[model samples]
Target chain A: MAESTKKKKKGGRKKSDAEMEVKAEEASEQADVSEETTDQEAIAAESAGDETTDEGDNQVAAPKRPDPDWQKAEKPDLSLDERLQGLEEDQLRQMMKDMLLARRFEEKAAEAYALGKIGGFCHLYIGQEAVVTGAVHAQTPDDYVMTAYREHAHALQVGMEPGVVMAELFGKETGCSRGKGGSMHMFDKERNYLGGHGIVGGQVPLALGVAWAIKYRKEERVMQVYMGEAAVNQGAFHESLNMAALWGLPVVFIVENNRFGMGTAWERASSLYDISQKSKAYAMPGRVADGMDVLDMYRVTKEAVDRAREDSGPTLIEARTYRFVGHSMSDPVHGVYRTKEDVEEHKEQKDPIRLFADVLDEAGIVSQEELEEMDDEAKRISAESVEFADEAPDPEPSALYEDVYANEDVNGRLYFDGRERP
Target chain B: MAEITYREALNQALAEEMERDPDVFLMGEEVGVYNGAYKVSKGLLDRFGEMRVVDTPITELGFTGLGVGSAMVGLRPVIEFMTYNFSILAFDQVVNSAAKLLSMSGGQFPIPITFRGPTGAALQLSAQHSQALEAMYAHFPGIKVVVPGTPADAKGLLKTSIRDDDPVAFFEGEMLYNIKGEVPEDEDFTIPLGVAEVKNEGSDVSIITHGKMVHVALQAAGKLAEDEVSAEVLDLRCLRPLDTDAILATVAKTNRVVILEEGWPYGGISTTLTTLIQEEAFDHLDAPILRVTQADVPMPYAKGLEKLAKPSVERVVEQVNKVLYR
Candidate 1:
């Protein structure tokens, strides 16, 4: 057998050196199988008839065959000049500023969560700014955006005010959801940001439905639905993909593969490490983009958004990125599944905001002083959001009965009339 | 007026709604081309084409969520579930997404969707396929639950359900689909939801029921009249926004009451009606309100066992006799 065909496990270190040595010996022995028998058995297995006659009956069923078509989408490698080719200086500055704003806003949210000002699950979008920022930039205002719980950046990119979003986190009446929905349920009807759905992969089908509505109305709009890598395992994800492809709905499913679903790594949970390739089963084009690079994120998503707008079909784009913080505010930042050193290394080397700043500086689009000022402005806005949330009034007790139904005739009767119990 | 079967009435409602509004569409498993599992959506695909009448894969969660999403953006979607038993697969979407989206989103999105299908036991279909799920769905706050007893009511209520601006679980009794009744020929005919109808009025006893049980109650009432005892039958068309006024007025007239339902006794719709009667018409009642409910067990496949599991005409008469002290 070819040595390359022997599986090599690649991940964390083994707990014991003795165990590693034993595994290596076993792997070497398995790689010594005769090449001729392997080829003959392969031909026999592929043959149409079920013949009981076995030429190499004793040969251990060739270890489960790998998916031959399983190949990762090629990552584009554009030169700095090439990356900056089509981008205007103003647009580049705005994208960098948006990334910076998202980072600063999340940092404030984390601090507020620790201070007990914010409650429920507060998933910070610290290192994944470029994914939402660039994707939002590529789509028109008519486009719809739906995402999972980790969507503070998405809410901001889709034009929800910082104060209203923070106020929602504070559970105040002035919040976008009128304090009914907390951080994970942020919604803006005017902006066409569907929601920050709490259920994992729950919004995939809903997004397709929105796309269906757009197509039904003959509107030239696309729906962009975002989910995590881990959500690909959910049945709704596959169901939605199939329906979208079958109906030719105008939707782009963006999977932000940040490597970890909470503490469980993507490799630990999924058999297909490359989630984008799963789109092939539904007969849709799937692509991968560097999530840390804003320009690349925009370029790939723009193609998808255009295809959808033209009523071609749905596309699945997997954005490769990393999360600098833990899964949510409740999770400790380090020393569990991931180390503190790894977090620091990602922050120092590939922080999306920092990467965008470097690109801006190299292109001489924005100077260091201007970047520092932008950081200060973002900090000011984030601090004001905290103050606004603190000052916002609590929802009235009567507000509890509101919004359950749009038909007012059925609304506002919380209890049975003249009855002691509801 | 025209006499038609319950299935034909439902088909007419879907056809009319599709013709009335371009935004309205029907999608579900076997709803198109295959002509629906129960033939309730028969001829819709041929009439409206594939776009208006969609044939979805057997994905209840996906298609239900899709319906909710479409409704949120100003389209009315009629999503069929083949049967209420299979709707269990889409329970999360129905309860969490469709029902709660309006309230959770602060009224920004109103799900104008109808989840329609056959409910309750049919012949030998047992256990999973035989559940009457009105009590389960009516428990949620934001969604409406409507169960029609006759062909006319089926057509009217279904049209109302589709036109309503909120999510509605329109449950059609599997056993009642073939029953014929006179329905109005008006294209705009729609019975308002949350209203109860007095199918039969009598002076002796009040029998309150919904869906197929309404027929059973009427049969029991007929038998009681043969014995010189009069009985009134009140059909509750909608379960969620229950018609308390109609219930109270019926109790006032008859002075004695018996509640009948096909669902299990525990936490069933009968339990709610009993509480309402005791609270509002306690002084008018001559005896304690009695309830004839299904046995509290999963429906069995055996014909005898299935008959015992569901409410029967004899059981209703027995409950009425006990309430009347006759």
Candidate 2:
């Protein structure tokens, strides 16, 4: 099967695509040679009467044949027009509008952080708008969504009011989490957006448990947990995947491979080149989607969601994407870990919002004037959200003691203790 | 009422809670098939089946966080750590996720999960295996730390901890599991948390303690009575909600007090109790409160050294003598 795929790739190469054919051939040959060498080493170790080393050696040793089941499925080669063929005009417009709204909202948040209006660890999701927008499109209101700290786009995409999110960023009483949780910890129970966890890979187990609860209740709702490529290295991630597969949980583990985890690039941090390959270890199907293409992401995630709803179990997805902005507002915009040229290249060519906008234009679903009108509308809404955040009251002083527990009397006794103790 | 071992009492509480609330479930290493490391969850898997009584892999952080997440979505999960020492592996989930989620999410989620396990020194279990971490858990605000002394208190407090609408760190004494005492037969009977009980009342020196050390305090009180010392043994059932009024009343009645705990002296529960006594009942105190604690060192493996490292009846008696000016 692998040989046929390689032959097909070679046969399809045009004379003008000579360089691409050479690169593909080189990659295939390199993989085959590495596998051959690993197998030879394992056999040599076995003949040497050192069976103790077999365990470690066998982990990297190549199998006798390529695993057709474990191999990643080929991504569709559909053109933008072909991919957008079946999508209704209204839904496509809505997707573009939501992406623009997320982009503009983060732009305003960045401006607020610069002005010191927002405080404490503001993680802007400027470059990753399409990933969440497409995922939200794939999910139902009954499904649960959770993510890492970079989650303003997720909250907004899940139908949280833009004003509430901005207010949360501003630390006002009217925020989604009532000002106690700032930018890193947005939660809305009504929407079933579980949380925006601060710790890396912290939400993996929670997503597993939520899926387990849904299963226990005999409900068809699925859980979607998002994390960065770097979080795939965490123990909790492996543990969660193991349990999710063991229990046949209804979950979709989405890894937004944004190329960088905080300041560290994925290449420097991960041992595995493709994060989706991790699913093979758990005996589950792994898929890779073009995260910059909203329709592709939606199509892939919607399939996984449907599979989970049918009690078919979990799926792991590695959404190949890039974050054009720095890791956070604290990171320099240029020339620290990443070069300015790289950022500019991604912004110009692979930006999700820009790519989606171009698709809309090619499809004639939206005109340039309509695009500008949507942009203006997004800007106006973002500006209004900022204004609302600015005028919203600071959390009342007594709020410091509230929400600590469900029982108010316990809070009172804890805060207003009459008994003096050293 | 029926006489039962503290281990049996804990098992009864788990069985009763699992029977009463369909939402309640138990999970831990060796809890289902192996019948628990200490047999505290013996026969529970048979009664509750595999779903409600689960045997998890050695992944502590994974299942602990799972319990926290399950509790958030309307389930009462009782997570067991084989020993409190093993719980250190899951401290991030316990502290950052379970304890702080309720407040961090602005009361949108309430974590009604109980992390229970055998704690403190148990015979020759070395430094890593033997640690009383009640005070460490009590230091956090959103978590309630419960340390039940007797079998009756164990069953009662375990039931209450399972039902409470907060994250609870129930540190059961390793040494007290086999100790037998009279426990109420009623399935609905429960003891409220944060309430101290007078295990043995007297008039001279007050011996304040909790967990397994309560047994030592009671034994020392019996010895002190022979010397006409009349020591009062006040068992603190819960550490976080330190029952200051009960502690102060005991101090006012007895005047001289000795705080005993089987934990490191530095920042131990005894230290907190001593400070509370001196601040609230200083005028009532006849002498400065003295604390009897484990030797400020890691528990050694040798039986003799382990005995020396923990709080014993002799040490409690000696502290009582000093507080009594004998």
| Highest DockQ against the true fold, candidate | 1
DockQ of all predictions against the true structure, Cα-based: 0.61, 0.49
How many steric clashes does model 2 contain?
0
List the candidate 1 regions with Cα displacement exceeding 4 Å: A1-73, A410-422
Tens-digit per-residue lDDT, A1-422, candidate 2: 23224433443321211232344553553465345544545676579765433223233323232122111223566666557747789989999999999999999999999999999998887777878888778889889999999999999988899999999999999999989899999999999988889899988988888887887778889999999888999999999999888888899999998777788777567645566667868877676777877887886787678778875488898887778777889887654777898778778877888888888888888989999999999999999999999999998877876677654333112322443432
- Predicted model with the maximum TM-score: 2
- With candidate 2 superimposed using the best TM-score fit, by how many Å does residue B130's alpha carbon deviate from the native? 0.7
User: Where in model 2 is the C-alpha error above 4 Å?
Assistant: A1-74, A79-82, A408-422
Judge candidate 1 against the unseen true structure and give its global Cα lDDT, from 0 to 1.
0.84
- For B1-326, candidate 2 gives per-residue lDDT tens digits of 99999999999999999999999999889999999999999999999898899899899989998898888888889999999999998998998888888887878999899999999988798899999888788877788888998999999999988988889899998888889999999999998877889999899988989999888888898888888888889888988666777888889898998888888889877877777667667899888888888899888999989888888889888878887788
- Fnat by candidate, in order: 0.57, 0.46
